[model samples]
Target: MSPAKAPAKPVRILLAKVGLDGHDRGVKVVARALRDAGYEVIYTGLRQTPEMVVDAALQEDAQVIGLSLHSGAHMTLFPAVVSELKKKNATDIIVFGGGIIPDDDVEELKKQGVAELFTPGTPLQDIVEWLRKRFPSS
Candidate 1:
């Protein structure tokens, strides 16, 4: 008889709020949506530092890192997370974010290694689909 194969593991995504951003309604909604779509999500509650976020990502063995920022600190915070990930030799982890970021800032953030940025009114399904497409094996 042939041996049974193990089940495929669900994609692991770490969602976080960096800096002093306390408004978490949007992040919470994204978390729920991702979970409902069959992805394993780890949400580090409000007010996470870049260091805390990268560390959590490492500890969680996450395939993707999603930062929810609304404090207009994306220029500083996003790069910090990317730099920390590089320092730890963890650049393979995809970093993405969403919030009140301006168009010019979004382009620059992407140049700095943020995979994608979602603004307000971006459909939740779009985010879910993007993640699935970006990290298909995740």
Candidate 2:
């Protein structure tokens, strides 16, 4: 008889709060939800710089990088993280974010290569499904 195959590894997600934003409740909630949904989450606490976030993602070998920005600095911070990841040849790391971001800014960020932006009221299930669909196990 043929042997059974082992299960694939869980997806790793890196969640961070970049810049001067100290409010982390939202990120924490998302982190917990992702963990409960079976994703390995690495949350970098508040006041993290763009470089720091990208470095953590690289070190953790995360497949997704989710930023929770409530300080209205998504424009600068998101692009900075994307830029840093590009610099390190890590553009394959999916970049997404959520916060008090305006609609116009969301379009701009997407144009700049942000995979997606989840605003307030976005369901945790939605995020979970999205990740699962895109990064399904081998």
Candidate 3:
């Protein structure tokens, strides 16, 4: 008799900060939480452009691309990243955002394929749980 094998682990994720967003305390917290939740998180440093973020995600072979934007440039940045990913034919990557984003922009960001948006004071456990369901922890 043969034993059944376990399923492969879910895809890894990249947590990045795009643009000149100096405030990274929240991003750091979430990164630690995600790592503790069993995801291989690639944390890109601050002031990255959309192209750079996408490039890092691609190079890291990440499945989930999370952007932490506090610079209020998300209106130009998030969509640009998404569009660049599309241009690169990277369709399987899931994107999300977190930061000091307004309510209206959050909806628009979702419409543009951001899976979810998290503002300040969002619980790290909640974000981790969401990733667990969305990407599944090994």
Cα misplacement distance, residue 59 of candidate 1 (Å): 0.7
What global local distance difference test value does model 1 have? 0.92
lDDT: the better of candidates 1 and 3: 1
The regions of model 1 sitting more than 4 angstroms off are: 1-7
Candidate 2 lDDT for residue 66: 97
**RMSD of each candidate relative to the true structure:** 4.1, 3.8, 4.4
Residues 1-138, candidate 1, lDDT per residue (tens digit)?
A: 895443288888999999988989999999999988888899989899999999999999998999999998999999999999999999999999999999999999999999999999999999989987986764
Q: What is the lDDT of candidate 3?
A: 0.84
Residues 45-89, candidate 3: write the lDDT tens digits.
888898998899899999989899887898889999899999999
Model 2: per-residue lDDT, tens digit, 17-118?
999988989999999998887888998799999999999999999999999999988999999999999999999999999999899999999999999999
Off by over 4 Å in 3: 1-10
**TM of each candidate vs. truth:** 0.93, 0.92, 0.89
